[model samples]
Target chain A: MMCENQPGALIKMDLGSLTQTAHDPIHLLPCEIQYDGHAAVDKYFTPTICQGVSAKEVSFRGRPLKGQEIKIPAGYIGLVVEENHRPCSEEEGRTVCMKSTFLSFTQWNLETLPSADDCAMMSLMWPKISEAIHRPVDSEE
Target chain B: MELEKFERNNWGSCRLSSLVPPLCRNQHCCLGIDEAGRGPVLGPMVYGICFCPLSNKQDLEELKVADSKTLSEAERERLFEKLDSLKEYLGWALQILSPNVISTSMQQRVKYNLNALSHDTAIALIQYALDSGVQLREVFVDTVGPAEKYQEKLKQRFPELEITVKPKADSLFPIVSAASICAKVARDRAVKSWKFLEDLGDVNLDYGSGYPNDPKTKEWLARNLDPVFGYPQFVRFSWSTAQTIVDSRAVPVRWDDCDGDEKSSSKGSQSMLSFFARKKDDTKHQPHRFFQERKLETVKDL
Candidate 1:
């Protein structure tokens, strides 16, 4: 699938400073939802978060969901993209449009607060590690 | 009915009450408090209060109010209906603690246990009566914990009222029995008509009794277990019965505050030298535990 070449218009090269205005915060839920479709998340899943001793508490569809704010690593940003139409052919890549940008998102877990030891949190360390590995080696060391 | 409002916001607690009977407001009244669905692994726990003028004690007894535990579902329903008919002589209220609220409160970081939740609900119901101008002179409660301590607590909260907290107060006092019937009937209807907010298509409602030991409830819990999300919100997730099922059947989840033995052992065994062993010649050097715990590693190749 990667060998096939397909092209689509880029609406904008950079959505500069989209995070200037306050907007709905994005969440990374722990569970897998089977459907891949747009949902009325604001209307349906309105989260009422409360402060706990060490974490935040919320409920999703009557189930307890614990969460913690996960800030994006320094020098990193998150982008949300949307595609209204599906590609008609395998060779035609789907057109993607920039929706919003965020510097951080809440990581939610089922009944427990996620820690740095979680896989998703750990993966965020890759960029710094990669840069350190590829840096030029000093000859005078 | 107020139950509709509760169903709409099923994640929170809801209170339902009848208008304060004029007789109760005019004369000194006796109030009884009881709860239902306390032991169930599914559905809500309901705290109910029934109050009537002390002069109408015989009328309450005439309604054949007895221990709700000894009565069948049909008998409880009949008694509740009979109690409802005498609205002019009696006033009642219920506080329905939803399963979601119960689970979340119990599982909070500071850990609010079920007994505390029950006591708070009962206290709230009693306070609601007093606020609504019910001239309650006496209060009887079916205790969940040590009777003397619970009675002392209630007395401390409402010193003006003569409070009686005893085990099996439902069987001993007709007013408490009436409260038990209201609680049991409300709990039964709530559990029976519970609507799943999730889109679990074509799921059946055959979970029997909601008790942890009931075979039918056990079967339903096992059958409906979601490997990723655990059971749906219908379950009381804080219950050991439910937690046992999740721990054994669902994916293992680790929390930050949990001092699990596995986490302690991994941290305890690490040596100070392992932190400084970053040498160019050592191709076999092990990564730090921070990476190992999260299963992160340097990919040598794409």
Candidate 2:
């Protein structure tokens, strides 16, 4: 399926020096939250992590979440983007700014560990695979 | 009745106490320990200790505080109130363990069982009373597990005090009967005033005794189960009754340690060779160990 915005929103991401500095680690949670606006994640979701038998255990809202920190592959950079405001009209293309960067993020599972079956961990492998697949092939071969 | 502690964080256990009887503190006192709601799949388990001057044992008997299990809810309430009226001669303390705490502790990686939790709560209540200057010379406890072992454990903890543990101590000892009443009444109140942290609308308070075998409780557990979240914090998630409902009704959650070793045990040195031989034709497209472990694949479209 293809989705096209007629006057597509243009996200002008500035991966400039200001945004290159590392920020706090990110976390990918299993559950979906209804609201999408800014949240006081630092204040409310301060995770007290303990090492479990096979994973890192954390309690979020009285529920157990287990996972581990996954680092970005070498020679790769992760950028965090944020929009200043919604565009007034469709004609006014959206501009999202790069807020910060991160080298690693914690991937959480609901009462489980981040495993090969998790889509987030699976998706992270793209850069390494892409780099190998797109490499120059010898004409002699 | 003094529930100000719950106001801070409702999910954790809290202690409540009656005034330390001024006269009882100076005299040789007998303390009794008992617990309520241990069989329930819902609500908190309360450990109560009731103590009074050894001379006031007759007063407790006169008040007709029998085994709480033998009394109706109404009779228990009346007797509890009567006991409260004689607060000048008696004192009581309760350690209320929240369902959340019970569930979390039992389900920990190290696995703290219910019996250990109960023993600890009972011990804590006794220590708290002693620390508060109760002249406790003897303690009577309704046994959990083997009577001898529990008695031995308590004797080790408080060698000075005479500790007696028996299965039906509540029926034989008036002070223990009084402690049972305190535990039962406090458990009832805790269940009655429980507020759901989840946004469950108009929850039915009548969960019917909360015992696993109660039909009304079984139905309540079935009806109240949320497909994704399982049950509210009121339910003991570690209870097999709650776990069965979750297994059948809730979404599947796979923990890493559960089956990790079992899957790898069948494989040996030839596993890598077998894998290479099986997918030789598609080796170029095959994902690396990192991707395979997380079950990831390259996207063909956005």
Per-residue lDDT tens digits for candidate 1, residues A1-102, read 122133332223234445453445887776555445455454334334656668876675335677888878899877776555765665444444556777
**Predictions in order: lDDT:** 0.80, 0.80
> What is the C-alpha lDDT profile of model 2 across B1-302, one tens digit per residue?
66557534446789999999998779999999999999999998999999999999998898888999999999999988888778788899999998878887887667888999999999999999999999999999999999999999999999999999999999999999999999999898888878765556588877898999999999998887655556767888999999998877766655555556667776644556686576656646666676677666553322
Distance from true location, Cα of B187 in model 1, Å: 0.4
Question: Top TM-score: which candidate number?
Answer: 1
Off by over 4 Å in 2: A1-141, B264-302
Q: Write the per-residue lDDT of candidate 1 for residues B1-302, one digit (tens) a residue.
A: 26897887666789988878888889999999999999999999999999999999998888778999999999898888889878888989999898988887887667898888888888898899889899999999999999999899889989999999999999989999999999999899999989877667688789999999999999999898866557667799988889998878866655555546678899989999988988666687788786787667553311
Prediction 2 global C-alpha lDDT: 0.80
- Listed models, DockQ each: 0.12, 0.10
lDDT of 2 by residue, A1-141 (tens): 111445244555555654456587787776554345554444334424557679986554345678888888888877776777877776666655677788888988877667875777677778887788899998997
Residue pairs of candidate 1 with colliding backbone atoms: none
